[model samples]
Target chain A: MAAASAERRGPRDTIAVSVRDVGMVFGDVHAVRNASFDLPKGRFLTILGPSGSGKTTLLRMIAGFDAPTSGEIYINDRPVSAVPPHRRAIGMVFQKLALFPHMTAAENVAFPLKMRRHDARAIPEKVERYLELVRLGGYGGRRINELSGGQQQRVAIARALVFEPDLLLLDEPLAALDRKLREEMQLEFRRIQKELGVTTINVTHDQREALVVSDEVIVMEGGLIQQKAEPVQAYRTPANAFVANFIGVTNFIEGVVAARDGASVSVSAHGCTLPGVAVGEALAGGDACAGAVRAEQIRIAPRAETLGNLDTLVEGTVVDAIFEGERIVYEVRVPGLGDQLFRVFDHDPVNHLQFSPGDSVCLGWNARDMHVFKK
Target chain B: MRRSRAAYPWTWRVMDGLESLAARLWPARFEKGLPYLMLAPAVLLVGILVLGLVQIGDSSLRVLDTSTFLMSEDLTLANYQRALTESFFATVAGRSLLGSVIVTIVTLIFAFPYAYLMVRTPSSALRKFLLVALFLPFFIGQVVRAYGWLIILGNQGMVNEALGLVGVPPMRLLYNYPAVLFGLVQYMLPFAVLMLAPALTAIPAELESAASSLGANWLRTFRHVVLPLARPGLVGAGLVVVTLSLTDFAIPAILGGGSQDFIANAIYDQFFRTSDQGMGATLSLMLVAVGSLLVGLVFMLFGAGTLAMTGGRK
Candidate 1:
């Protein structure tokens, strides 16, 4: 109980796996173009992207399954580009879970040991230790197919770790599982990685999975790294329009920065100005800057014009209203900006949501809640 | 009360219930069975061929009087004993087994590399041309191919003529065991390649990389992963080549010079030339049984050994 308390207070160390200008191409098709990042070790770094954003390719190069066409990879301060996967001592749990279909759980765990050509006598014992570590205590003799999806995932982890690899790469390992099981595996993986203190890099396209599991999330799009930062940090402070839109729902309105104040600014859009928006300087403040209003941050019925000692408001015509369980998705048409979507959540009573799809109402937020970026 | 049918038992009620359930089920199952109805003619053809083979087996088991259509004499093991114990027939069987084993092993070694190259190498036209070339020798008349070899390896033939031009005397080359082995391998290489190519294609490219990533280089990967996986196909090819070698007559006849008589040639001699139909039938049955047993043993060893454990209960 005391040790658990200590662990709760203890934070992870800051060792990083640096990928430098790594790119790959099959003939003329560029798979990854100058993909680079300092993936902090001992914390989950998920490169979240759609299929063929070169996410899996990046992971493969890091795992040494494929060598980079052009750059260097350093894990724990060693150049690992030329190193073979087994020699590099990195473990990779494949997307298909690539468990040798014929081998038992013990044999699967013993594979890395076999690859290292360890003493045949010691393989069984080493295998049992890792299997037990993964909480598969008595499943050593069970075949891979005998294990359920989650159990097989744990066995794959055990197999990868049996040799105590320096780095572990998981290439979308939960892509095949159903929703509930995938979420369960995500939590289980986090706990195991923390307990083991092994540096792991996981590649996944599921944004929620990435957000829940990773310490740092690197968002990629169209073969380029869009943003790499902490999960909450990336969510709160997206570096670009792509990062903002890709991470979640945001009402990005094209505008120009018109006036600036101490911690707030005004963005002129579609002939009218949205005043008191925060153009926080991730990008240098310029006149032609774009502004964003997140749907979740938009207030619906709490229209008490409360911005400092004064008030600011913009009127929009409500075009559609969607009941999204606990929240309402309002598709409103601002006077000149055309259509804008805002999500109002369930915090107050139902009578407050007194607008229909065709009704016109004034919507506004605190200047600090809005974000402005370069157009 | 009369409508209730007072004599009806509970078992009858259950049967009626089951009948209704089955009536509901049968149409859907018969709708699925439409596909099998389409296969009926082909299946019947196969059944007829199997029935024919069974009749041949029955005929081999009897004592043929030759004077009667049916077996007028008593059934006998004497034919089988006569076929097995005869020195010439025994020697012929031994020769066929030994020759086929050597030839098949050599064919396997040569064929796997060439087949692997066909799959991995990047040239499509080259692979196609090579595939055509592989069949070219087989496409030529068997007599013509044998005679062509006879010319190449004979004392006064092209090979000896070339050597003689270089001031070397013609060496003896016609009709020998060396000639027979050469002819057998040449004859069976196409068969070996046809078997191996499909197996090589079936091996996923990921497996090769998987092995390589696990630190096994080309040779170790080929041995542990490639070869073991390809064994089923290799064994299948071996059965075909060995059976072909056992049942072969022309290759041995052309090259054996009466010294390397195969079982087929001996069976041929017994059936018509020597007028011993009983011994011939018995010998042919023995060869068939040998091939079947060999194939069955191989399947039991390799195919059955791959019995897999379930992978979901963890």
Candidate 2:
């Protein structure tokens, strides 16, 4: 298999894909506007967004399916805006998998090799190698409809990578699978991508899939990239309110900045002062601001005195409590913070006492966990 | 299980009354026969057709006595023997068969691209324009369309008049085998396209894009992927066009100038012009047998393309 040789040649630290000021407009609607990003070799970058957020448009442009209206895209520093999709050395697993229903799994895997006119003698060995790469060694002769959905997905992946293209694109191939299979395939894709060290760009609306599979996640909204960062940085330090609201369940506290100290700022809302880390644009005193804190970042205690060694604490009453299998989510309405309701997740439910509705509680979090942004 | 009737809603009571009334009118066993009851009219219509065919079969065995202008009382195979032996009937049958094959091949070749473009075009106006052009001939009768072609293709017609302006002599473009074949093709184009459109539409656009991404160019993609996937539509459209053209009478009657006669034209002459019912009935039965044999051959070779009558396992 070429996989062993591919692994021997480790991934190089060079820019694999570069998009410069790309824009796409269809009649009156601006589908993608002023998008730009660079992905290094052998890294997995996922463009994450909701439907109609231009993520798919951007991916299509990169794949040479759609031409950008404004700027150019480069594969290995060569501008490819004029190249046709067939000529481009890129493999794509479509949103629907797009496996040919008429062909057997082996034929499906052999298509790219046949199209590229690989050596006639080497075709079968290569096909079998890729089928084995996808862990479908003995089942290559089965037609597409005879295979399960997950097996069909493996066929698509193998077919896309059979030619050993310079770059691979995944267009939400797991969006239709059930949750368990989707998660399993996410890990499977990550493993295959790493093993082959193929530069890949995946587009998906599922944020969890993005975080699980991608080395970097690019969050998009309304035809613009809101933030592009590593998964941890994106989850911990979102660039703006959209990224914060889109990535995870976050509670926003609307207030005015009363004090600013380097990276930290104090925001006053409903006559209560709260400390938070200042992110994005600089903030001056009396400037309108919003504080974002993730549900898991905040801890809920039975009393204010019980939660010690925290940066900020506020007393509130539990307005609602939902018991999920792994964790319990509590919605607390703080009286001192503009009567705002904050969600806190209790991960250690067995060790910690569960607070029911109408029970008095205290919500506490570190100042670094709260991201303060200009409203 | 019996529940209190008074406890149920008024709607339930009304439904119950209707159900009991139905039960009294039709026994429960009759429910199983409802589908066959609905099929009775179609079956009766076919039975009547079979009876007429039987009568025709009997009549085709008798010879017409020209002196008395009446069929002979004694049955014989004279009509069939004469039809098989006559050179005129052989020429007509051969012309019809050859012309139908040519027309079907030409029509399918033209209709496939037209149907594909109509189905794949992104512009709604273009698709609507193609659809309107296809159906416009349907609004005009086949005979009228054939005559329209005659006027357009005749010497000193619109085309010849345009040619005259260029200082060229008026050419006889109508009333020939080519003209008859051309008319048949034009008439059958829409039927072929209509039959093929649904099958083409069943192909998802993603498959094309997928093929292109997998390194097949547009032409290769069409040849390898689109063409194979559209086999059922092609076969179905081919069958319809072939049979329709083989039995067609109007195009040859109007465009052939009485020189190129199809099977239906010959049958018409046998029944109406010569008033030979025996010969007409013989020719009619032969036409049916020929069409059915062609269709049967197709089903055997292609396994009912796009009909999907086969088991799921293939």
Model 2 C-alpha lDDT per residue in residues B1-314, reported as the tens digit of each score: 35676888999989999999989988898999888988999999999999999999998988889999899999899899998999999999999989999999999999999999999999999999999999999899898998899789888699999999999999999889999999999999999999899889878899999999999999989987899888888888999899999999999999998998999999999999999999999999999998899889988997677655432432
Error of 2 at A113 (Å): 0.8
lDDT of 2 by residue, A1-375 (tens): 112112222355688998888999999999988888878899999999999999999999999999999999999999999999999999999999988878999999988888889997999999999999999999999999999999999999999999999999999899999999999999999999999999999999999998999998999899988888888888988989889988988999999999998888999998888999998556788999999999999988887777789999988999998887788888899888868889888998466547879999888999999899998
Per-residue lDDT of candidate 1, residues A1-375 (tens digit): 112112232355454588778889989988888877765567778899888888888888887878899989998888988787657777778787766654688877876688679999998888888988889989999977778989999998887777877787888989999999999999988988899888888899888888888887888887778777778977887777777777777877777777777657877877777764453454334568777767776665424353223234566777777776566677777665655554444344565456787786666665666677776
Worst 10 residues of 2 chain A by lDDT: A1-10
Best by DockQ: 2
- The regions of model 2 sitting more than 4 angstroms off are A1-12, A351-353, B1-29, B308-314
Q: On a 0 to 100 scale, what is the lDDT of residue A39 in model 2?
A: 83
Model 1 agreement with the true structure over B1-314: per-residue lDDT tens digits: 75596579989888988988977867665877878978999999999988866765665666656666345356678777766687877788888888888888888888888888887777899899879989999899666787788878887789999999999999878677778888888888888888778767766766566555555677777776788767656876777777777677888888776677888888788777856666677787898888778667766776522212221222
